[model samples]
Target: MLRAELAGVFRRRRTLGLLAGLAGLPVIAGLALYFSGSSHGHGPVFLDQVTHNGVFLALVGLVVSGQLFLPLAVSVVAGDSIAGEAAVGTLRYILTRPVRRRRLLVSKLVAIVAFAVVAALVVAASGLVTGAVLFPLGRVTTLSGFTIGLPQGVARIAAAAAVVGLSMAGLAAVGLFVSTLTEAPMGAMAATAAVFIVSLVMEGIPQLSILEPYLMTTHWMAFTDLFRVPISWTGIERDLGTQAVWGLLAGLAAWARFGTSDVTS
Candidate 1:
């Protein structure tokens, strides 16, 4: 069941388009910088570093996409998980089969999570390739003002991608819950995206400082800590913990709603 779910999720044209679009960001950025001959410290956070080391493009792509692009992409996939099936009048038919609701729900969640992980890695991988082709690939500088070999730097970038990918778990669960609330995939997608945007907006407000510690977007950028000489785990640990709590709450809510709801479609 899980394998079928994954295959279905990956075989869609929409999924391919999303992945391609993600990979395009890094390639476009690399081309722009390469053609323009930008000097040191002239571009955004990681792009500046990319000028010195191509490996930084991986970090740059993750940062660029993590903000809204990646989350929005996740919203589309996850929001469509259950709702899309229902909209197409397949949810009722599927429920008539021997598959349990719990198992089906689990499968959908796994598919979305898988999509999220692949989406993140796509950004990292494309960035690395583009960066390598456009700029010099060599030693990478750490956030702590130290340098590491190219292989170690690449490993850290891969680690950062994994962390960023897992960071979407909370959003994926929330999207699933929202999906269960409606039959319209667009509605669920919009609502899920709104949740992420609202969280980001609230996190920016001064009065919301107390709530910032729990917002899904709060520790997203903490992946940069991986580039530190000693690698700080405080922010990354808190980020994963927060995601786990959110995922648990949303998953329970989704199960309750899905298990009890009538399947007319």
Candidate 2:
């Protein structure tokens, strides 16, 4: 079932377009950096200059996309999972089968997560290839001014990619939850995107100090702290914890909504 769901999603033109757009972003960034003449600088060129500046910049763009576009992409898949079928009058046929609601929801969630993972890797691969082509790759310089050799730099990039991917699971769960609430695919996508945008806006308010910690957007950039010298696990741990809580809550909400949903209509 999961495989079938995945195949269906991959066959969509929207998904293919999104993949192309994501893959092109880093290449565009790389070209921009190359023409900007910002590559020349002092101190271990590989560390102080290339890796730090290039990778971090690419990451910032990737993170921004994650916060904004990625959720929409997840919603594009999840938001359409059941609601789309219902809209097309195919859901009644699906529900006529003996498949359990829980199993159906689980399969859909798995497919959504799988898509998210692939999307993330596409972003990372685009960034890495761009970084390596436009900027010299060797060692990386930490935010705290420490230098990491080439091998270590490679490892850190991999770890960073993993962290970013995990962080997005929260957004994926939110999309899944929204999916169960509506028959309109656009509504689910917009609702999920609006929530993140609102969170980001709220996170920016100076007086929202009390609300910031509760905002998922606040912790979305926690992976950036990993690049600091000595590597601050505190922020990353908190981020992961918060994400886990959100994911669980959203998953429960999705399950509850879907279980009680009337698909016979």
Candidate 3:
């Protein structure tokens, strides 16, 4: 069942398009930066470093898409997990099989999580290739003012991608829950996207500092810590912990709702 679910998820044109679009992000960014040129201490978080070390493009692309694009993609896929099937009137038939509701939900969630990880890795891989072709490849300077060899730098980029990818699992769970609540995929997608956007906005407000720690987006940029000289895991751990808690709650809620809910199309 899990294998079939994964195959179905990846075989869709929509999934292919999403992955292609994600891959383009780093390529476009690298091309623009290569042509226009960037200086040290200029632009966004990793833009400056991208020119000096091609691998930084992986980080830059992740940062660029972290805010909105990646979330939207995750939301769309997750939102469609159940709702899209229902919208097309196949969910009811799927439920007619011997598959238990809990198992089906689990399969959908796993597929969504897989897509999320692939999405992040696509960006990183694309960035790495594009950056390597367009810029110089060499050692990477840690955010803490220390240098590391290219191999370690690449490994860190891969690690950062994994962190970013796993971070979406929590949102994937939320989106899956939302998908169960409605048959309209667009509605689920929009609501899920709004949740992330609202969390991001609220996290930015000083008055919400007390609530910030609980927000899903609070620790998104924590991947930057991976680039530090000593590689601080505090922020990354907090982010993963936050994501786990959220995913757990949402997954439970989804199981509770989906387990007993009636299927109609």
lDDT value for model 1: 0.91
Model 2: CA > 4 A from native: 39-61
Indicate the worst ten consecutive residues by lDDT in candidate 2: 43-52
- lDDT, candidate 2, at 104: 78
Per-candidate RMSD, Å: 1.1, 3.7, 1.1
TM-scores for candidates 1 onward, in order: 0.97, 0.86, 0.97
For model 2, the local distance difference test gives: 0.71
lDDT of each: 0.91, 0.71, 0.91
Better of 2 and 3 by lDDT: 3
Clashing pairs in 1: none
- For model 3, the superposed segments whose C-alpha errors exceed 4 Å read none
lDDT of 2 by residue, 181-219 (tens): 878878887787777778889988999879888777777
Q: Give the alpha carbon lDDT tens digit for every residue of 18-77 in model 1.
A: 999999999988888888777467655777778778888888899999888999999999
lDDT of 2 at 146: 86
**Candidate 3 clash pair list:** none
